[model samples]
Target chain A: MTEVKKTYKHYVDGKFVRSESGKVYAIDLKNEKYEIPLTSKKDLRDAVTSSKAGFTKWNSLTMYNKSQILYRLSEMIEGNKESYIILLQDHGLRKNEAKNDIENSINTIIWYAGLVDKWEQLTGNLNPVAGEYFNISHQEPIGVTFTLNSNSISLDDLVKSFLPALTVGCSVINFSEKNAVIALKLSEDINNSDFPAGSLNIIAGKFENIVEDVGGHVEIKHAAIYDDISKESKTIIGEKGSESVKRISFQPPTSGLSSILPFIETKTVWHPKGK
Target chain B: MNNWEYAESIESEKIVKIEKKYGHFINGEFVSPNSKKYLDTISPSSEEVLSSISIGNEKDVDFAVNAAKEGLKQWSKTSPSERSKYLFKLARLIQERSREFAVLESLDGGKPIKESRDFDLPQVAQNFFYYAGWADKIDLAWGSEISKPYGVVGQIIPWNFPLLMLSWKVAPALATGNTVVLKPAETTPLTALLFAELCDEVGLPKGVFNLITGDGTTGSELVNHKDIKKIAFTGSTSVGKYIQKSLAGRDVGLTLELGGKAANIVYNDAALDEAVEGVVNGIFFNQGHVCCAGSRLLVQEDIHDIFISKLEKRMQTLRVGNPLDKNTDIGAINSKDQLDKITNLVNEGVSDGGELFQIECELPKNGFWFKPSLFTGVQANYKIATEEIFGPVLTTLTFRTPDEAVEIANNTEYGLSAGIWTEKGSKILWTADRLDAGVIWANTFNKFDPASPFGGYKESGFGREGGRHGLLSYIKASS
Candidate 1:
């Protein structure tokens, strides 16, 4: 007897729910049947709103607490690595490719989790500004970010963008057009982990709908798009989002201190350092 | 009220000579612009022509850029110690001639001499000194791998803080081993011209630092220049957007320090007197021409009446007169056009049913001047509350709760700077955390240091201009 396939739905507002349009698309992996909720533009709006609300809660946590939560999520993913490898292989990865996918995804999460509490020191400073003022700059998250990945991107590449933004305290709304099933499974791991609800919203749908909806949302401070998407779509988001000065970039950093810097802003606070 | 007025203590301007014609500084020397055009820069306090500065066109910008490109080859190759020495020399020279620069700053910029001397010139010198220290140590500054400098930086500064803004741009760019071509604002070019003389006096290498004088057209030419590797601009939001759009497809770096309508929040548990002083200094400093000035006053509803009364009484004591006067508390507006913009916006605020308050003071007739005005009982949507008036105008709004104050504060499109007044330490940190601004001054206003990273989020622009992050604006790190 065949085991029953698990149905996948859009994760929004810390809950798994069907698309508002009630549309579902099938994902066929190795002749095994899986279904993905077809998220619409309205769903993107809801996810953005939820992600913004999530940003406040997540950003309020201390760096230590955030680091703990990210670390816990990586541990959970590592504990379930065997299952993830099976999932990747079932989704079309060869044996080595599947193992490598699970391994890299776990390592990316762990790397960013370790960096969660330390990035500020790498990017911030107590500036000797030539005054009696104790001036210091601290890197702060830029609020909710909208991330998009191509249809052909591996689960590891998607995690690379999501984890860095998450590590920096920014809540993310990711639209993965090609690998929604695996992305949804990762969201389940996130929800089951110590992460607050709405912190990581995963939507499976056409890239155009999500980008267009993100264009109108002023609450989204930054958007990281994998350049695999069309240039016209990127231009549309850039032009429509220009009113709010949304930082739209196709050059997503893959590694280094800058990988997390793009997801945050620098805040300098000044007070009198008087006797 | 003071029944007797204090005697005028006008600072003498005779220490500095006014030139009839000023040429652009290029390749370590003053050269006539290729455009062959000149515009008169006048004293905002006297309406007297201080000097005629060259109005550079595209060709002139090209020449300046080319000079900077050649300068870059030498500058980028110079040892960090040599760069540090040049900047130190510039800083010391500025200090030795501080009075001259101060008088020229007051004359051409219409800031009170006390400010030009005490605040502007000192900060200018300190800025150079601070960046001078970084010249030899930039590799270890950014906390990353060794970074390389971008070539030929084009900087455009606003009129409000002419010399100080120039110091902020040039000091860091040069410290990072980049050559510069800078455009001084059309209305205030004297101090920058004076600065160029110091560069020549210091025997700085030819083509290391070039200064071109012109209007917005010249700024656009520099912004659109093909060879400039980076653009650093401090101006309005609209122009910042235009420049960002112009460089949409290019790989050149850009950092903009744009406009702001920052909100100053006063809690009921605050020290009301100090808060009032901070509010005044916040908006009235620089004739309210400061990009990060606290233009919106958000007071708790409980102390709203008492705070307004105290603030009005304080505003009344501000002396608005000749900028050269040491006794003058409020100086002339930067320009006639700026004064008109302030007048129109304040008028609109009054028409929008906001109560208007102004200090009754005698003003000089010849130059640009406006009463330090206030609009109370303002709603969140009032134009004066939302827009950057960029003059000595403050709009007062009241909120009953801390969350509401944060809501109103973050509602504006600009988030450059914010001030929080409260004795409660936790509340200060809490409010500072939520406000969208880049710089938060707790119980202080308009305080800047060369080490502080100053810029804004949203429409106020991108990239920090000071501190270690500031060096990143000029340097590119290898992956």
Candidate 2:
């Protein structure tokens, strides 16, 4: 008896389907290459639509519950550590660095998971002036972020940039780096975890052509690019992202491996104990 | 007589004596250093030794930090109103004795008398006055319910704008209740020393502000000092990187205002007359010694030919002889080393197949000076376009669309500041959003205010230096 092979499609809107555009890109992981399917523009629209629907309910959830879900995702990544290491190694990382990268990715998720309940305390509190009836301030998630991962650290950098946005309840549309086979594998791992379908979507294509379109999209509230390029590239990215006044962050030339725990805003809500 | 011969006569007329002995300012007094090593402060314009300053070795840094540590206790405890009063008094006193400060700064630092009087001395006083207002009203500036100071800040300022840079550092820090141990650049230490004297005259508490004179080693000693809670530096990006590396494992707060290769974009629809002025001010201001100066000009292809011709014609009319002259439009290069770097980069641009556009004006022979230069038909990868010349040299490139202009503008590691000139209001806003620079000028150039936030992005360095955002360098978010 002969066994039948199975192929997976993009997991979007709680279902897996072939790209509507019928586009598939081959992932080049060093000497070995495999066909990894990507989400089309139509698929992306569907994911964003689902994410918008889920956001209201997800944002209103208690911080504790949100934290619990993030922690579960971290645990799931930990369980798939061996597979992740293989994926990273295939993307040109040395054995030890690959292990470290995987560990760091998990640690990043866990760090932001803990910050879910404490953003308000870190950002600040509002003063109640003499005549004001009520005064309060809190940092809400900026909304859907379009992230461009660096080619250098395909999997780890993506995780590091994405987790913080997610911890704050912002959905992400990540543009994986060219030849990022490991990142696609990691995306599959995330899909298998309890994260709602369309909460995180991955796309692969020509960077220059696609960057402007993604940046100009009105649905994207913010964008971050991690590539090292000329000042001209930065300006184009800025201008493209300006269509929607997207909060743009360009990673400096220094290593992006530093812990971002300090930057995360923690909201701490306090009420009268006597109540 | 030729300008060179005239400059020589003027140089000979100023027969100033160079002093050899100096001391460190610790605990509100000048004290003889434990280590006797010294750095020679030379006049960039004449290459003459103006003074030999005692370099602050590690021991001196320790002494200064200890003094600041003690100063922080009482100084931070004082009411903001009291601090404001003290600063206001100091500002007035400095103004009253402006001549002495200007003369000393020009003699030691080789800046023109006009700049000393008009820019350095006045801006320093203005900084104190501006920050003085914030001292008592800081609660309004901080969005948070409570604000706290980071004690014992270590500051290192550059040579270009000695007194002004010092005020930029010390005013906000002191206003926010942080005691400072500041190290003036090796070549320019007199103005800061004079400031220390003024601090005493104003009855600022002992140890509230300490002055240390030194080069990079001394700055490193102070930055690495154990008692220092924060570091504020303004200089080259290379040094900024070193400081970042040194403070990697530690929790020390840092604010770096470093190098820039900023862009100035001109559209075909721009007001050509206003843009001509912007181009001149962009690269020629302060002899191009400013870190945020727009060193690159990206003109629209439609106007490139006409704009370059008009710009060069305007450059030729600029007076470049003497910085002390009230009519001098461009001053001498800050230092001989800086002059050499500029000429070398200009020569590289020519060698790389770009055309040079000199002003056709003569330069003084004795002092370190270079006529304003422009290079057109240069590629983005050209060394002159990519590297920071830090002198009155400008590079020109052409772009077709707004997007292309933005593409050219943001193509550098330094994102300090940029200029946009167009008649349309919407275009100005559109161009500004695309420029990666921190400060975007619309239809104007080099206009600065105490109310406006100013800083750089990427390798131009982290942190801001003006307005409410500037106060963040002195405050601790923790408490």
Candidate 3:
């Protein structure tokens, strides 16, 4: 008798719950198959609520503290490379390709870890005016982004979208790719790290239906659709997102397997130090 | 002679005078050019010298940019309400001096008085007013995050609607807290110089808005300036492509609102009277110089004859005369080079075996004029149909079905805007869905509001202006 690997339900608000829709998608790995639970609309809403609740305290943390937490997450991801490689291989990646995927995924998190303190220098500044008063500009975070992970290189793509947004202190309600078992395990690692509940939530489900449901919800401040699909699907996603007028970013085909550094507000506090 | 004929004959006797020796607007004053070199801007209407405007070289652009960089610090620090007050003041001043601005726009750009007064000036004022409300409410503009301005925007405006395009560029850039170094079209530099004087009168802070006047060299220098953070341009597709290629590997952000060969479809079920009005307004508006003007009329084959007949009759009624006239419908082409291009393209249509139908109205001999023209039996592959004529020329093609209409509509590389005229609600929605242009209009043509976002897809350009999306062009996405 052969042993089978078991799939688990999503964790939301520090609790693991089965999908309310009672639906699951099967992940095929070579000759083997496993049932991965799909998150329901209710689960998505719960995740958003969790993220929104966790945003205030996470956003209030000092940049230095946030940087340390992100660095810790990166370290954990690096330490667990073999498990991530096996998970990637299960999702159709060959051995060498899976190694590259895991390496790129961990590197993305580490890259953002390095950028934690430099964000302010890059985005915020004081202006020089011919006046008596001082002028300062800061970059601030947008709240609770609803991100869709691209089907290609699922773990790396999910990490690319998640880390930069988290590094800037914005919590994310992320919809990972349907076959992204590795991303789920990565989320578990995140939970073990100092990342609080609701700071990051991962779900897996039907791409079109679940994204549409998530897009229709009002609390999703911004949404990024991350697949190369038909024009009709783009329109459907665009119109669905207009319900809340969510800030949408359509990723073009040939978007690299690297994370984009999104702009965040970095408030600089300056006082008369000499005085 | 009839009363109208006598009035027209008398108005033709008076010659319009062109100015000389224009100055640059820098550091809150009309200052001498950094370089003494000047360019002679010719009046396209008469091929006469309109003005000798100071041509800003790289040195002038740098000076204006430095001024803007200096002002950016102080201006970005002001409270949103305080910023809103300044925009409000500028908007009121524009409205108060609307007549002067309108006349100056007509004199420099050769657009008719009615358009400059009724359409251009009012919309310019409204743009400022609309963005004024946005200044204090930028928090709402972003997705629950406070928006910050990009530093020192370099803007280049086109000659089609000089002051109107300037207002579109300036108002939104200012509202979002970015200071600007703007370069108006060299041919139509008068109105922009006058706008600088108004800024001074309104006590807008020094170095907040600087105007540099020159041709392509000046525009190129401004775009390549290392200190400038973003570039917003409205102009030809060729020039836009050049700018994009030039900035390929650089970090300078760009928002281009470029040229278009928009399609205006008229179905058999469309209201004939309204369709005729839309066709007239579509092609002849601004003498068809608009980037989003409906240059291709895709009428359903069933209603092709009737629509063209009505359009021809309506075109005959349009008054093509002096731009200063209160009743002129079509004005002179903006320049002699533009007039020659219109003539060359229309000649090509005739040589290519398409039937030419001119409006049977006589053109003035002294000014740069071309009678409004329509080409029947125009193929989708014809040069007249594919290229942007940017003149009062319409190319007519017929489509058999709604899907065919959409096929012909999306055939062009430019996708700035498209129009659909049909009484069926379902078809309107269907066509709007398929048309690849940024804006799709039903039962109307060329209607714009500051609340509505406007831009093009594909080669027509990227990025948008107006509405919440307009705010995105000036601010970095994350901040």
Candidate 4:
């Protein structure tokens, strides 16, 4: 009997779809019987558009609801832990290491889910701006984030980049190259869960093809990238994103809330409440 | 154009006493610079040299840093109450001599006397008074006693809002028990020099507050000084990036309140009269040299025509003339270079097919002057819409929905401030929630208080410079 090879599509907007350019490449992992979409610049543009559309709906969700959806997504990931661990093993990880990665990934989601409601009180303030006006400031999501990270990143590190942004109500167009299948499987779990469509998009392809377009996209408020890119690439990102002043940060070993805080902008609203 | 002209209401320039030449203020007194080079500080309104200021070089900066390092030893050991008392005395003295400072600010910075008197002077005094009380009570600033002041801060201020920016940087650093080596912007060093006099009157500890006078070279020396513990700068974004790069591998703390091209979104449901007023104040204030100036006007498409018409009519009524005039709404541009930059950008807007509108008024011929102007029909990618022109040039773009308004508003590299004008409460909250800016003014614009922390997101720069949050940049956690 001959085994059937499955072709994975880029998960964008709300559904899995083939690249607009009809480009595909065989997976680099050993013993994998699948190929992933080599997403095009147009596909990346479509993902940004979808992520922008998703931002309104996802950001409009109450913190409680977002927390609930995030919790559900984490549970789905945990439920599919065995499959994810097998995929990680096939992608050149020891079984124990793969299990740890899966566990840490799930834990990261849960950690950020718990922070969804508590972030406001922790950072927000009814500032004592000396005047006759009542001034209050709170953190708000920074719309769509375009993340270009290293393919060598662990699943835990990859998800860490998106979790804080997601918890703050931002939609993410996350790009990965080497771990394409794992990113695709995680997207499937997100799609099946209560997570809103376009809230999280996973694109797998050649990094060179879509980087400039994604970095320069006007709609993307945040861009998280690995520091491994050339100085010329950083300069290009700086020049392209100069107009709207995109908040681009090279990932540090440990981001925690520091990564999340930069992506969350403060909004102080004043009203005439004083007599 | 409105045919309403009033007699000149010039505030007397006799109130300010300009010295023939000035030296760097180090330790407790003015001293000659190690380098003999001097630059004449010129008044933009008259094109006359107000004074010759010593051009501080690398050695001058080193002298000031050494003074601050010595000052920090006793300053850090001083009782918090004593520091608070010193600030209180300084605030009172500033209030007493504010008229002199206002006249000097108008003469040196080319801002209208009315604004210098009514807005700048009061705010300068207020900043001192507000931060004065914080000196003795900094224990309550953070959650625990873990916060400790970073010693010997290097402060570099800008030409716009010269004295007020100094107060903002100086007050918080002192309140948090840190000595300062400040370099005032070259074009407007007189007010800072006068401020040094006030410091002496208050008997602030010798070497506690040192002032260096020079151009960008002097600023570079101060920033790169090895002994300087932290850097606080307010200037152009390009310079802010240079500072960031310079301090990348160093352990020095840094804070920047840089450039901004803010968005003022006026919805169809907004009160048109109030909205128009807000738009004018947001952009035209300080001749639009403000870092948080609402340079981009995003009017909802439904009421775009009416708002633009009303705004134009309002622009016509603005009196542009001598900075010393009591009724002047606009003044001379800060310098010849800044004037050229504004002219180039405005001409670019015209070439790009943007509808240019300017107040029909004759400007003074001998001075650096650019008419208060605006561009309508501006696309998002237009140079006028994207860059910080840093003059009284506003770019108007229309949008149909709140979402589109937000899209246009957030499409800039600078995010220091934004203004949302709508009568609907929920809509204000909704729009404000979506806007990516550090300060969002709903139904109001260009409103500032020393107690309100102000800074920027993204390229607008980082670190808050007012309120309790402002103290964070001056101190670090003990852990």
Worst 10 residues of 1 chain B by lDDT: B139-148
The fnat of each candidate, in order, is 0.52, 0.00, 0.00, 0.33
B1-479: candidate 2 lDDT, tens digit per residue? 65654332132224333346678899999988878888777666666777778888999999999999999888978999999998898889889877778767776666667777777888778778888888887666654433578888999999888988998999999998999999998888988888888899999999999999988899999878888888999999888867765654355777778888888889999889879988899888888888988899989999998998899888988877665555666767767678888888899899999999888777777778888889998998999999988888899988999998898888877777888888876887677655666666676677554444566655666566766666766774432
Mark the regions of model 1 whose C-alpha exceeds 4 Å error after superposition: A1-9, A16-40, A83-94, A129-131, A150-153, A178-182, A204-216, A226-235, A273-275, B1-5
Number of the predicted model whose lDDT against the real structure is largest: 1
Give the runs in model 2 whose Cα sits over 4 Å from its true position: A1-275, B1-20
In model 3, the Cα lDDT at residue A106 comes to 71
Candidate 4 predicts chain B with a TM-score of 0.98
Q: Write the per-residue lDDT of candidate 4 for residues A1-275, one digit (tens) a residue.
A: 22325788888887999998998887756566677889888888899889998998899999999998888888998999998888889888999999999999889888888989987776567878767777876777877998775666377877876787888889988888877777888888888877788989999898777667766787887787753676666656655654444566655323444446646666666665532
Best by DockQ: 1
Candidate 3 contains a number of clashing pairs equal to: 6
- Cα lDDT of model 1 by residue, A141-209, tens digit: 888998886455366787886887888899999888768888898888888787777788889877766
Question: How does chain B score by TM in each prediction?
Answer: 0.98, 0.94, 0.96, 0.98
Which regions of candidate 4 fall more than 4 Å away from where they truly are? A1-60, A69-112, A142-166, A170-263, A272-275, B1-5, B79-81, B136-139, B301-305, B377-381
How well is each residue in A30-138 modelled by candidate 3, as lDDT tens digits?
5456666687777787788898987766777788888788888878878888887877777778888988877877777777777777765554445332223232334
Instruction: Give the TM-score (vs. native) of candidate 2.
Output: 0.68
Candidate 2 lDDT by residue in tens digits, A175-210: 664644555556666766666666666665545645
**After superposition, which runs of candidate 3 have C-alpha atoms over 4 Å from their true positions?**
A1-275, B1-6, B9-19, B144-146
DockQ of each: 0.46, 0.04, 0.03, 0.21
